[model samples]
Target chain A: MQHTDNFQEITHHHDYDREASRKEVIRVTVILTVITLVELALGFWLMSIHQELMRHFIKGLICIFMLAKAFYIVGYFMHLKHELRNMIMTIVVPLLLFVWFIIAFLADGNSYKNLRNKYDPHHVEESKTKVDKPVHGEEHGAKKEGAIE
Target chain B: MAQAVPAEQKWWSGGKSPFNVEYGKLMMWYFLMSDAFTFGAFLISYGTIRFSSNNWPDPNEVFQSFPGLGSGYPLAFVSLMTFILIISSVTMVLAVQAGHAMDKKSVIKYLIWTIIGGLAFLSCQAWEWTHLHHEGAWWGSNPFLNMDGTKASTNFTNFFFTITGFHGFHVFSGVIINIIMLIMTINDVFERRGHYLMIEKAGLYWHFVDLVWVFVFTCFYLI
Candidate 1:
């Protein structure tokens, strides 16, 4: 195989030596396609089995599928698979934590809504008792009738 | 300049570098990694809200714009857009291959095709957005239809806007970059400069835009 001059080689790494990056990109693309299909299938299955599952679980599953696709793209096609261990971790670990933070926040909000439903069933009469009667108008007339009765 | 000694001379072998890649390629990897995370965050937040809510509208039911057919045929328009984006990714691969073979003409042709593909995808998206906006489908406008119909949530609509809008922005910028790089290559600028790394890096960026669209089509439209 013919090689470029040394000066030309100095600036560009050409790590895959031409043939390899070409082959690697195709391989990575195929992997991405397959994973995408599986994720779509999983999404369909989730939606079909239970309406609640689709509402509650499908979103999380989509996130996981997206994360997987992102991993392969970065690792292979973007050539992160060829980078330093520390650099790879530096990029990935924090992203994982960031996603976790979002999930936790959403979960807490959901649980708080549930707890409010369970512990504090708001009642209309209890709320009405605290309202001050109007000094004038139909409501005040109604209050007078209540006082008479 | 003293540390300019070549780091790894083996060419194909592993390096002392942490991921065994050279600095330029490693940085590209890191940039892509961060970019992936940014996209992930947007899509995941979309998922969180849509999941937490009840009776969200199905994507297929909402984005049913058919291509070359009567208006409002579900998902046809966006499906065509998805196919166009995938084909653009193929063109990008061809450009990279031409770069590897040092074939300037082929590289320019493929890049031009890729740019066209990007533009076509953007136009489709613009149409879809306009149609949705015209239909009174503003974000978070009662995600459910009625008691008998599927419950609609604004969360779904909001995500449909934010994530897809951000991705559309990326594709727009990608086309601009491809055009610039194409012009430079055809003028023999890259050849004279003896640097095809820019072409390769730009190819990665372009592919990423394509990759994200694939997921968006599935999660946001198909599912």
Candidate 2:
């Protein structure tokens, strides 16, 4: 029953520290509540701002605040902060790929948007008068090829 | 005879270190990390579509209506829902503390509180979905592409349903597990086993749900 003894030893002070734990939980609750309210306020302010660049800056700030809240929840409540360093990295290092996922997928989607706009019917029809007709002509094609080379 | 039979106690078994955590507990952490990636994929796709589109849906306008408040409240209802989930996380941690102390009474009480908070969040989602339905934005209607009047992307709302619905299901399952733990606490199951690690396991899950909601609220409502 070595494992049983180990668990009991780990939980030994659990009773004596109940009050302290309560205070800690409440402290975290207050901090989270405050941050949430601040995020909401700043979000509304961003919404009201007309400048696009300024709004983007504020949105970035809001993301930072959200990340801070996440840090608190994971570290304190989930007890990850108390865990050993290797275990922490085992969880966090993999999550960095999320940032990569966002960038990679967003880049692909933006390219798709660009492709869609470039091949749009109106633009395609407009370009047909300027470039395609001459490119189909043998003389112009030959001349353009010679000039390019 | 009792004194002669006594043996020395030790924390580690002189074996392989399993992520510096107990086996069952570390596995839960690993499960949560994997779950986080799934949610990460969903949110990343959401951002992809959102940035790719010209006229993305306005979360403020879409989330304006609150029950009994009629309209004009932007993000207020969603904020309240987030608040409830955060506080529930608090209750859950408290329950874990109680379990560590072998205090069954406090465990039952806090678990009930957590369960209530989860139910409240689900109900709020129902009201929000109902409001959207009446406005012609049901599961079938694409919010972004449907330009009848609400300047939104069909892809946006479809992802919204898929992601939030999945998260809500997690919360649903969390509450169910909490209830089972509550019953077990009442039955002295942990007492017989000489520990309350089950409560800690449940706390891990509840906190993970809270953690995911933070991202969802940011991706869905704030950003």
Chain B alone, TM-score of each model? 0.85, 0.88
Cα RMSD for predicted model 2: 11.3
Candidate maximizing DockQ: 2
Instruction: At residue A119, give the lDDT of candidate 2.
Output: 67
Q: Candidate 1: list runs displaced more than 4 Å.
A: A1-20, A37-48, A51-65, A116-149, B1-38, B70-77, B139-153
How far out, in Å, is residue A20 in model 1? 4.6
TM-score of 1: 0.71
Which CAPRI category fits model 1? incorrect
Point out the worst 10-residue segment of candidate 1 chain B by lDDT. Answer: B142-151
For model 2, residues B1-223, the per-residue Cα lDDT tens digits are 0111113532246643434456788889989999998988888878877666544556786678889989899888999999999989999999898887878888889999999998999899888887776665644453322112322325666777888899999999998999999889889898888778888988999999999999899888887
Point to the candidate with the largest lDDT.
2
List ranges where model 2 is wrong by over 4 Å.
A1-3, A6-16, A121-149, B1-20, B143-151
